[model samples]
Target: MDPFDSSDDSDDDIFFRMMYHYYTTDLLQPDPTSLLTRCAMLNRNREEGHKHLYRDYFADNCVYGAKDFKRRFRLSRDVFLRIANALESRYKFFQLRYDARDRREFTTLQKCAAAIRLMAMGESPDTMDDYMRMSERTARESLYTLSRGVVEAFGDVYLRKPSSHALQELYVVHEERHGFPGMIGSIYCTH
Candidate 1:
């Protein structure tokens, strides 16, 4: 019968309890932004990105050939696909997935390409949005994920120091290619 008493299942008492809880908990919490600004979910057409990438580099009858792919990406398409496939298999993040809104996320190719473009072109993360249709944050994350994946997957094969014999062979090859008998690095002319 009392308006303030929570013992009875009354609307007024319930409101009071909610207000008290809100003041004690949520009200005390600091607001991150002074302005009532919230980030809106951008509709970056990820599917188109994937499709364009595929058409340009991955498809059987892709617009670009192996030479162009290598020229633009700084690697052969075969090697790129190998790295991408490896990352997708090893990392859950690289795998195709759906968001809470049931929207399909970026494909493995898109993510890998984003990362590779950033590395190869030395471009900013936001630059990928124009062609890749991914947000800057996503592009940045993709770069990091791809780097870690490549290091983990192909570290031993590609990242390890050259063995004595391998080093000797490399010296020979460099000498042959550049006509420099004992060139260790990319010094063109020491004259």
Candidate 2:
């Protein structure tokens, strides 16, 4: 018999027919309860309610005060403000805005603080929710946007190759400190 002929009643043909019938009649049908549940879940407010953690910990005169801000954020308050200002000015995403309902959104300082903390401490975004009062998704987005803004705004000055004068200065400092006249610096590798 021809392989494509439907008249064949072989075991292989029977198995193929059974599998096709099962998939089309059972596996392909959508469950109504699952669909409704998914819609309800999406419409529900899954986000945690507003918390004052950011204000209580960072804004108030807590451990993040002027004296300890540097230790916590790995940068002085003034320096942090400067960086935040630069980022906000350069990137509209970092700028604060009001929602359509006229609700004020997160400030640039908050976003920068969250992003900087994540970068400095190498912590997961979830860790910042308690302190920053931000969702993990928001925290991650802030980290990405802030990092890109910082690189765009400051990368040229900080990441550039050393100029001749700068290199000469480095060479002189190295020579004076190590007594190696021509050696600029040393690199160490560890396994």
Q: Identify the candidate with maximal TM-score.
A: 1
TM-score of 1: 0.76
Q: Locate the minimum summed-lDDT window of 10 residues in model 2.
A: 41-50
lDDT of 2 by residue, 44-148 (tens): 111222234344345555535776677777888777888989988888778878766566667777788889999988899988756566768878999999888
Give candidate 2's root-mean-square deviation (CA, Å). 10.9
Prediction 2 TM-score vs. true? 0.60
TM-score for each predicted model, relative to the true structure: 0.76, 0.60
Count the clashes in each prediction: 0, 0
lDDT of 2: 0.72
- lDDT winner among the candidates? 1
Candidates' RMSD to native: 14.9, 10.9
